[model samples]
Target chain A: MQFDVRLFALYRERAGASIVTIDLPEGASAGDLTAAVRADYPRLAPPEVRIVVAVNAEYADDDQLLQPGDEVCLIPPVSGGC
Target chain B: MIILTDEPLDPVAVTDSVRRDGNGAVVTFLGTTRDNFGGKEVTRLEYEAYDVMAIKKLQEVRDTLRADYGIEDIAIAHRTGRVDVGHISLVVAVASPHRVQAFEACHEAVNRIKTIVPIWKKEWFADGSRWVACEDHEFADEAEHAHAHAERHAVAAGD
Candidate 1:
């Protein structure tokens, strides 16, 4: 399966690209997407970091299943304020 | 009203929209860009938002506050792109039948927006710039991150 993930804030700055596409097995979970992103773009975060994931605008657990065309967003630690 | 705009925010318009009969008070919050941070001379600020998520979360906050505190009306407007010092970055307005719930609901609205909204603020210091609290509470350690995220969120909500 192919998944296109949206990036924001630090992840976009680090990755230097707003969207990343990852190829995975048919039954990939959010965790698998995280691992693949880490492997592909190490600069996005340190190896040990586990960034947040959002599926269709809602926070999704690491075990959440991925649909082929799901609108996934990679959320770094949010720092919203004045 | 819950909005994400790249244009300037008008607090008057936002607060006025929430005005209605039987509302005794309306509280509005304007989060402006400060001129300094930790002794650094700041020049301006840049804000970004996951528009879809941020707006959704803003609506969620309004709904939650209405149910939680029985507030009558609320409005939230956030700016995107670049914002200079002393300019408004956020506006949260709430109305209720009394003063207490108006203030309380507005307070909670601001708190919840920071904790959950996918908006980000980048501080532009004179010599350098940084994304405040971006990595300070995230991506450092695995075991303590859950706690740190919660604690940082508390700190954020408190502010």
Candidate 2:
């Protein structure tokens, strides 16, 4: 299956593209998508920071199963202004 | 009311929208772009958001506050794109029968927006620019802050 994942903020700036298409096997989980994104774009790797996955506009757990055509996003740490 | 605009925000309009004759207190919060950060002279601020998700999350904040505080009149407005220093970037307004709930809800509203909403802010300095709160340590700090906020909220709610 092909998933077109959306990127924003620092991730978008690092990836140099707003959207990237990833090829993943069917029945892949949201966690798998995150791994795939990092694998595809090595520059997106931030080992210390936890990048969250949002499936269809809601935060999705790692184990949550992904379906085709679902809106996926890579959410970086929000601006809390610490 | 939930608003996401690239244009400059009007706090008075948002506050007035939630005002009513029966309400005794109306609390408003305006988050402005500061002129400096960490002793670095800041030039401007640029905000970005996942628009659709941002609106949904903002509405969720309003709905949750209404349910928890029994306050129905609430409004939130956030600016997107370029916002210069001293400009308004966020506005949260809440009206209630008393001052306590109004103030608490308004405070909680801003916290919730910072945590859940998909808005991002970039700080521009004369030397360069940096994305605020993108660091790993900052995330950890925010988590701790959120934990503290949650505990305070629970205590305030008597939960």
Candidate 3:
């Protein structure tokens, strides 16, 4: 399965693109996508930092199964509130 | 009212939008761009967001506040794009029957928005710029500098 993972903030700048397409297995979970993104873009963030995955605009657990057309984005640490 | 806008946020209008006859207390919080950050002079701040998700998260924050504090009146407005120094970037207004609940709920709403909302800020200094809390390339260096500066300030105070 091919999934287009949306990147934001630092991830977007490091990757130099807003979206990156990756190929995964049929039953790949959200964790799998994270791993794949890390593998593809080593400079995106440090290994220790967790790359949060959001599906359909909500934070998804590691085990959440990603559908074909779900809105997937990588969220970095945020600093945007009053 | 929950809004993600590029235009300047009107605090008065946002506060008015949440006003009700039954509400006795209204608390409004505004987050503005500061000129200094960690000993560096910030020229301006730029914001970006995953718009669709940001709106959803703002709604979630409002709903959670109402559920937890029993405060039904809430309004949040956040700005995207460039915000100059000392300009308003965020406004959160809460109304409730009592002052305590309104204050508490408003505080919590800001905290929650910081954690969950899909918004990012970039601090532009005269020398360069870096995203706030990106935790990627520049954040580590900036963190160390901030820590060192803080320690220096503490030592100066002790002297």
Candidate 4:
């Protein structure tokens, strides 16, 4: 299955691209997607940066399963000033 | 409660929208454009949004507050487009039987909006502009991790 992932804020800057398309095997979980992102993009590896993932506009946990055509977004730390 | 606007926000109107006779306490929070962020002098602010997500998230916050506090009425409005210094960018109002609930609900509403909403602000300084994201309590660590991850990937890619 194929999923379209969005990178926002600093992630967008780091990726140098706003969107990335990832191909995952059947029955992939959010964790699988994260690992793929880390492996492919390299900018996603640990020290385990907390990147919030939204699947089709709803927040999803790492263990959440991904369906085909789900809109995935990697939300970086927001910069709302104090 | 209505949660969106492109025009300048009116705090009085937002407050009035939620006022009730049984509710003795009404708390309103107005987030305005400031002239400075850190050391940079902000001339103005430009707000953008993934409108669909922003509105949905704003409504979710309103619903959560209503459920958690037993708040009767609430209103949340956020301004988009160019807003000059001191102009209101966001407004949140809540009314309840007691002052404590009103205050607490209002505070939580605004905090949730800032943290979860998809709205983005670009601070235009004299020299340049930068996009602002919602800052969380654990922002520094998250930023460091994101930076390191990106750097490692870049190195592997031989960029």
User: Which prediction has the highest TM-score against the true structure?
Assistant: 3
Measured on C-alpha atoms, candidate 3 has an lDDT of 0.83
Clashing pairs in 1: none
lDDT of 3 by residue, B46-153 (tens): 999999999998999999898999879999999999999989999999999889999999998988887778888888999988777422323235654533343233
Chain A TM-score compared with the true chain A, each model in order: 0.93, 0.90, 0.94, 0.87
Q: Candidate 4, TM-score vs. the true structure?
A: 0.79
Pitting candidate 1 against candidate 3, the one with the higher DockQ is: 1
Residue pairs in candidate 2 whose N, alpha carbon or C atoms collide under 3 angstroms: none
Comparing chain B with the reference, what is the TM-score for each candidate?
Answer: 0.84, 0.84, 0.85, 0.84
Model 4: how far residue B134 lies from native, Å: 4.7
Go through the candidates in order and give each one's C-alpha lDDT.
Answer: 0.80, 0.81, 0.83, 0.73
Interface RMSD per candidate = 5.0, 7.7, 9.8, 8.1
Greater-lDDT candidate between 3 and 4: 3
Q: Model 3, B9: alpha-carbon shift in Å? A: 0.8
Which residue runs of candidate 1 sit more than 4 Å off their true CA positions? B134-159
For model 3 chain A, the run of ten residues with the poorest summed lDDT:
A43-52
> Residue by residue across B21-109, what tens digits does model 1's lDDT show?
88988889999988976566789999888999888988898899989997659999999989998999889888888899998888888
